[model samples]
Target: MIRLDRDGPVWTLTLDRPDKANALTREMLVQIRDAAAEAEQAGLAALILTGTGKVFSSGADIDAARAGLATDGVWEEVSSRIARLPFLTVAALNGTLAGGAFGMALACDLRLAVPGASFFYPVMRLGFLPQPSDPARLAALIGPSRARMLLMAGQKIDAETALAWGLVDRIVPREALVEEARALAEAPVAAPEHIRRTIKRMIRG
Candidate 1:
């Protein structure tokens, strides 16, 4: 499930499946993709992705994955859309980020985490590989060695470690996470829209 809220130039998309740890189902992924598309069309200055309750996302739904209904392509598409958005994008990790959800967080232009938040990549443990774009983008942000530690060794790093490793731009208290993200978003609004969009495209490419 997803919830979209708009406040001035910022649009926030919240993963709303607390009972399931915000684990994404195929339908949820589709909804996210559609939401990203909508945000792009709306010409919003910033987009913030967050989750309800404690967990940011537990990744794809296991049952859906077992049935072959949830595929890497779906997540790849969603992350790609978010990456290509022509405005500032932020991943406000309210809690743990693991599995395919890591790719989504990595795709954002900025990442903010709460003090106890952590990052994990479980592909090696699950006997699967991440979407092709995931590793490259992740490595670009945190370097190849640390990326390997996460993707290959399944290392889970807490907020401070993530900040030191350059995985997150900032770590704020849980209650201040959203406010800090909003402030970051607001700061970019003074830049020319075209310049921001062009720079983001250049960086992503």
Candidate 2:
């Protein structure tokens, strides 16, 4: 469900579920978390998350999420592992990032998006609550009002406005995102021990 490629200090994680628009399944979530743990142990400077096809992620597999909800605490347990990794997580949004898809990208410390990219969270349609982390991360990124608009109204914001709103750190041409993220990752690294623990603590805090 994920393909990991290491290039020096960067670890790129490609969502390998393109056939389903990268809809995340339970097993896929576990694989992603494991890769993040590995990246931290390997002293990688950062991790990049993206999808293989035009879509970044349509969100968690609704069918999967439905099946797991009654089982108690599945998504939280796994996504938290990836979210709290030692190295920085970068979501290289290739296209529309929607539904719980925002949660995965939100887990990232920074985001680099392409021109046509957009973000949305449509939890109401599924009759579920936002994982406690969503609102916090969204508010922190784009402020309370905008976060409310996006998360509650299920509004989708374009990449340019997302940059201006600070939801994304930067915007690049779609053709240049991977190279740009890798270059950005190279410069922001901290001493391994310091960066690793610091990022983990920050996310958890």
Best by TM-score: 1
Tens digits of per-residue lDDT, candidate 2, 24-75, equal 8778777777787787788777888888887898877868878864233555
Looking at model 1, the pairs that clash are none
- Candidate 1: how many backbone clashes? 0
Full-model lDDT for every candidate: 0.88, 0.79
TM-score of each: 0.94, 0.87
Clash number for candidate 2: 0
lDDT of 1 by residue, 4-86 (tens): 99777799999999999999888898899999999899878899999998999988888987877445588889988988899
Clashes of each: 0, 0
